[model samples]
Target: MPSMIEVRAPLEIKVDPQGGWELAFWVLDSFNYATPFRAMLIEIAEALAQHPIRSVSLPDYIVDEDFVEGTLLFNGSSLRVYYEHALSYLTLANDDRGVLTIVAQRVQSRIALI
Candidate 1:
């Protein structure tokens, strides 16, 4: 699996009327466009629903990056990436209110489960 997936944080970008989201927010500095990102988020929700990822530790404190920074494996590979960018890019990028709500719930549930 390709390593690295972040579960948190926001991003910023400079906007020019000449360019749309590609200039502003920069999709968390990756190239996947918005539509594909929406679908990926949905897929994440569904995957967790079907077979939730069990936590490896309680309280889940990490001493370093190695602990928390790694691939999220499903079906023996990471999420079908768009443009080979990090999945976390979508997590951090601008999302619709409903989409954000869904992601929030998913993260909350995962935290509770852990």
Candidate 2:
């Protein structure tokens, strides 16, 4: 059996238009230092492609009501990636349609910034 949690696109991609690709580059650039991070990112992308919601679990940090601030998770660990640094925010909603809408709005806002 697979993990109960499913991995989706990096949350940053939904909030930041350029964030996804930019993150890809950063991961590549910092391959030496960010190897684990990069690997986790790739794993997330792959999991999303295969099983968007059934492949990974949400980071505990996101579950905190006080932690309105978002961060990145990789290597089964949480890594702080500031909102300003993100190209987009990846939202997970109870409803699939809601998730798409939230992600879309964030992407639009990110595009507007450019």
Model 2 misplaced stretches (Cα beyond 4 Å): 1-35, 50-114
Model 1 agreement with the true structure over 9-111: per-residue lDDT tens digits: 4323323222222101113333322323333333454534534343111133333211122223333333221222433243221223333344444544332
Against the true structure, candidate 1 reaches a TM-score of: 0.24
Model 2 residue 33 CA deviation in Å: 1.1
Q: Which stretches of candidate 1 lie over 4 Å from their true place?
A: 1-43, 47-88, 91-96, 111-114
**Candidate 2 lDDT over residue span 21-112, tens digit each:** 22211222211331233234334434434232433443443221221233343323332332211322223322223443443343332221
Which 10 successive residues of model 1 have the least lDDT summed? 17-26
- Please report the TM-score between candidate 2 and the true structure: 0.20
- Could you tell me every candidate's TM-score relative to the true structure? 0.24, 0.20
The Cα local distance difference test for each model comes to 0.30, 0.30
